[model samples]
Target: MKKKLKFNRDWCKGCGICVEFCPKNVLELDDELKIYAPRSGDCIFCKMCELRCPDIAIQIIETQEESDEEK
Candidate 1:
């Protein structure tokens, strides 16, 4: 499964709760103190960041990658 992390930068307060809750350390703070995921590929879609975000800033977008076998 292919997944992506979406962040509402406007809602983030830089509390880092989501970062702390991330088991994979996929979330990080940028120079602006906003949340970002430099290691998104390591994410396991655990939704910890989404659930722990106090400001409701994080979301997990799950997508099924189409393989040639699907044709």
Candidate 2:
């Protein structure tokens, strides 16, 4: 299974909390104070960014492709 995190630049405040907390170094802040998912596949669905963001700009979603047998 793989997970993804998406950043809403407009809502981000350029805070580095997410970048600092991510164990995989998956996120980086741009000059405009917005966050970007530099390493999307490295995310472990920790949800730390989603929970800690003050502006509610980060979202994490699971993207496990269901096998044909499961379907």
Give TM per candidate: 0.81, 0.76
Give the least accurate 10-residue stretch of model 2, judged by summed lDDT. Answer: 62-71
Task: Look at candidate 2 and tell me the lDDT of residue 33.
Answer: 68
Question: Which parts of model 1 are misplaced by more than 4 Å?
Answer: 64-71
lDDT of 2 by residue, 1-71 (tens): 54567677788898799889988888888777688876766777789989999899898755675421110
Model 1 steric clash pairs: none
Across residues 27-61, which tens digit of lDDT does each residue of candidate 1 receive?
A: 78889999988877788889988988889988886
Q: Each candidate: how many clashes? A: 0, 0
Model-by-model lDDT, in order? 0.79, 0.75
